[model samples]
Target: MREDTTVSALDSLYLANSIFEGKLLQAAAKYPFTVSNFFKSFDDEPLGITTSADGVLIIYWWDTLTGGTQHAYSCVAQYKTAHGIKSVSPASPNKYSCSYSKIYSLKSKDKIYYLAVYDEILSYHDRCQGIQIFLIDKDDLMPAKLIKTQTGLHSKIDYLYNDNSMRDQNWENELTYHEKTQTLTIPVALENGNLTDNYITYKFNGEYFIKLKSK
Candidate 1:
């Protein structure tokens, strides 16, 4: 890459970081939360910290256990830059009972933050089930309307109902907003289909309304 191209990419990243930081800071002023724990899990030091985007500081932690299962959680919190924390609000507990990998994304736009999660479940029968995109607005924390949910089996897995079955379920439990198209896309896949690369995309306006959908 040329020097100018590199510089431009750096500038874009810096601007995005700045916007997220500003959101976190603002959230800190209102709620004021802090990290209360950090411990070693499965040989990895899992640290908890307060992060912000558009002045909203979000508290989160990630840990890996013996088996390949990774546990993680995040909640909106009040940030106090001086004291490091002010307080934290209680978030509704959510539990997923499946062997799967998860990813999260936070998108800041139009003065509101969007949250999304993607989960890929690998069944014992060699089947795969995916939840494309699930989303919630920062202000309400209520899940937005269901964009799309899909499930199927991978090709290598012959019998779809061999002792274990890949039931079509809501797996994409993560979300993030797209700045260019003002859309939210959550990564997802099917268990029986040859969909190694599939995603749920939603287009919305500033008023927090869904207008379009695509895979």
Candidate 2:
């Protein structure tokens, strides 16, 4: 690309970063978010920073004591130059606890970013089920659009959660993600077991992650 084109793209990225940072900082002040305060309230610590495909950063921490309810990210929203954290989340109850939660960035197309926030809890036996997948548009970084704030996968157009046989039963006992194909593969049990040798690949389809195929 030409120097001017490169510089213009950089400028656009910088502006987006600035807008997102300011929005988060204002939210922090209004929400009164702080590392000390978060640790005090929930006893959660910093989980580290993750950047999206659009240079948007989000800091995730584990959730605990949800009691079979939805949880939210303990602390989040950040920038390279400064960190903007909100102590609270508008997520479903107990959705983001530390016991069984995983957050990571998926593949990016253009300036858009896709984030996977997996929330799971064991309702009955030692087996953990009820896995929830969330996607985010990191560029916006707004409460209304930070996370899709919905249930199940394949949010729009198609529904992957219902397409699979594990709908009524549960997601699985465990989940695995492959970075090469940008697919989250979860093992589905064959008979009366937690997981079988066979697996299912959940791939992102721009809007939501869907069941690309099974093996």
Best prediction by TM-score: 2
Q: Across residues 136-208, which tens digit of lDDT does each residue of candidate 1 receive? A: 3333333333332233211111111211322454443334555667666544434544232345565545444
RMSD from true fold, candidate 1 = 17.5
* Cα lDDT, model 1, residue 60: 38
What is each predicted model's overall lDDT from 0 to 1?
0.36, 0.41
Candidate 2 lDDT over 1-215, as tens digits, reads 55553456546655654554455456544543342233243334334333344443444333322234333224444432234333223243233232224334554564334343334333333233333333333323432122122454332111112123444654443466566676666666644443554666666556556666677
Question: How many steric clashes between backbone atoms does each model show?
Answer: 37, 11
* Candidate 1 TM-score versus the reference: 0.39
| Runs in model 1 lying further than 4 Å from the true structure | 1-44, 48-50, 64-76, 79-86, 89-93, 97-111, 114-176, 193-195
Cα misplacement distance, residue 163 of candidate 1 (Å):
20
